[model samples]
Target: MSDPITPLAKANIPNPKDGEIVAVAEDIWWIKMPLPFRLNHVNLYVLLADDGLTVIDTGIYSDHIAQCWDALLAAPPFTDHPIRRIVVTHYHPDHIGYAHSLSERTGAEVLMSQIEHEKSMALTTLDDVAFADMMIKRYRMFGFDQDILNALAERGNHYSDKMTKTPDAGYIQAGDRLTSLSGDWHIRCDRGHSEHHIGLYDPARRIYLSGDFLLPRITPNIATPLAAAVDDMLGHYFAYLAEMLTWGDDWLVLPGHDWAFHAVSTRAAGLIRHHQQRLAQLLDHADHAPLTVKSAMDALFPMELNEHERYFASGEAHAHLYHLVKQNAMICAPDQHGVDYYELR
Candidate 1:
């Protein structure tokens, strides 16, 4: 089947260059920071109000980005108003990495969902070797070879090494409302990409602060959750995308990565169809033979991948296979040789 996913279009505004802040709205500013990956930037926002500025998702901690932040903070709006709250949408390194440092420097309250805050704390508490061992165990179950597993383990805590420790934070839950001069943002929570990811919506402004939950271009990574690797994570992702279809097309999405974009409902529909096609692709392949996560990953991503990409690809493949299992459309057909497969009947 033809994949419904296409290159999602961005809003007709200039994307901010690295370290340069652009005005997203009358009182909101956009700061794009460079990342050391293929998708090489993250979008952070500052919401201005009479009381102070509210930062939404601090960029990952890097000397260059930190220096940029220090210089930006020392200037006009921030210097005068000061930051009152640092709202983190999730616990991803790129999202919450600089939260602790920014809060320390600006005396801003770092606010995150209780589940996300706990996950952040766990990341800081777990040492590199321990986290790497966890990865090895998880990937081993996904049918990765020992040699690749060892290589991946050496990359140890790549997520944690990028940032400072998380500070104590206040919690925000689903249905919570944060009212300010910026607008009345109604907090909505969704899971799949992460255990509990938060998005803020302001109907009046027609804006959605979609923190990796609804990226315009690509579907967010729906990997196995750390707590339960076998859970049907992709199912949760599907449900969230279905919910987005009801949100109407008025939103100007401020995503965690990529430039701002319009048409929330369109993007959501495309993403949902994208996942459905992927699941069908796997099921069709399984009709020929029993499928393992490795086989599915290869079929889904028909390209040569480096070590990190391979690991992520495996996780995404596993999520889909397990989702099929959860829906009773497939059954696990494990081999005693320390690898697992699934058969779609």
Candidate 2:
């Protein structure tokens, strides 16, 4: 079940530098903003509206990025047209980080799904110490060592640092049609990567602004945030992938990261296979021996991980284990140490 890994190649869209805006499609501008992470950048889009421009996602809030926005707003095409509304795809810090700032600066309305808005509001007002304590408990349940718990407790408001305040937002839902500057855009609420993540599709143009639900080269990280405590994150992810597979193959998927791609069906299938293989390995390991989430993660993700990445790795390991338990492929019990152990059913 351990399939050989093949690198995914993106479509022929050039990588844009920080503060650079590239015209990826007609009347659509791709703006890249820097993130202080390995992924490094998020793609924000600008769609030409009738009298002004509508922004897709706002980059993380920072003075440096603010200067970039100032420059962009003062530039030729942007100067001629003001930003009227800002629509965010999800509640991720990078996507909605600067939404409030931009809305306040330009008096632009913020639009997002109701669940995402509620989750974002929850995250923005989270108590750091209490959240860290909760994370420690979750990690302990997943069999994380005391060292990891200490590191997590010392993490010190890391999540809040990346985000600004969430603004008053209007709600969007699945099957809703939003009339934008381009045309009527259909909203699709996809879960898994984030709760109720919204992706906009333009039937006339065959274009989909897919956010984190579908990326060009990499599968989005599925973590169990306190705001979203679903045990079946991968299940939700696969459901979304299967749904995307039914979409027409000619769609130009404008992802939150990486280049815009034409083969979403192919990408979705590849991601599905990847997860299926992971689940197979997980099942095989559990069949051989009862294991904790930490042991399972060690077997599944062999690469070395930093303290921050450990959080996602543990959550993803729990996700797979939870999926197996839900499917009755595995059974779980608490060990003497009060940690969960899973074995094949």
Candidate 3:
């Protein structure tokens, strides 16, 4: 079913400058933080509590970001107000960046899903050689060449660069209720973008603070990393999309990136169709001959990619291939050379 039109126009949303807080609702502030990537920025929300402030999603750790947080938190309205807690939507570097540091600084509890917390801790202690070895094997199976394999190995231990410390987080599961200044926020966990991406919804106000699960126009990457090999990532994504379609169309969607939007059910349907098209394209491409994940990745995303981007590219291709196999629409198996290849069933 189609969704109702958004009450607010897209052009009506205010453009927030770096570190500048713009009120989305009563006492709820949206803060955009800068990032050194193609995506450019992340939106962090500050919620006013009776005693202090509750900060959600800390941007990556850096001297510049630190300065911005210091100045913003020390300014009026928040000058004497201490940070009550640090809540993360997921384990991604950008979302959980300064979680550990801020928790230490404010002595505030860090809250997130159990899997996100465990994964964050696991990545910190994960052995570099073992990780590199596993990545090399997976990449090689997906048809990566020797030179690219060496480059992937050199990429080594990426978690340390983005996250400075391990967060000792308190767990918040699906269906849990959190009391905020605005109203009672219910936690809903979805998988596809991450192992356990958390979404906060307030039914009374019809607002959803969607972490990367829902974005304005940009579709969140649906990749399956090694840790999520057993999970049907794309299947989970489609189910979650269907559920979002049932939400009241009037709810304002506060996403992790870009601007806040309202036509959520429309956006959810669009994302469902987007993945369906990608899956169809993969099937058509493989119909010609057995295709490697690398070949499928190139066909689906033709742009030149850096080493880091290549990781996501591989993951995305793997997601489609794995999902097709799960649905019995494609055949995936190893060849004599030990590389995995797919063909239309």
Model 2 clash pairs are none
lDDT string for model 1 (1-345, tens) is 113377667788768898778877767778887777666888888887778888998888888778988878877667667899999988888888888899999899988899888888876787878888887877766787888888867788877787888778999999998766768889988988888898888889888889888887767888876634467778888888888899887778888887788888888888887888899999999999988888899899888888767767888899999999998999986678757889975
Sorting all predicted structures by lDDT, with the top scorer first, yields: 1, 2, 3
**Where's the lowest-lDDT run of ten residues in candidate 2?**
1-10
- Per-candidate total of colliding backbone pairs: 0, 0, 0
Across 205-269, the per-residue lDDT of candidate 3 in tens digits comes to 88889989888757787777664455678888998999989884688888898888887788888
10 residues in a row with least lDDT, candidate 1: 1-10
Per-residue lDDT value at 243 in model 1: 88
The Cα RMSD in angstroms, rounded to one decimal, for candidate 3 relative to the true structure is: 3.3
Stronger candidate by lDDT (1 vs 3): 1
Candidate 2 residue 129 C-alpha distance from true site, Å: 0.8
Residue 229 of candidate 2: its Cα lDDT?
A: 60
Which residue pairs in candidate 3 have backbone atoms (N, alpha carbon, C) closer than 3 angstroms, thus clashing? none
**Poorly placed runs, candidate 2 (over 4 Å):** 1-9, 12-15
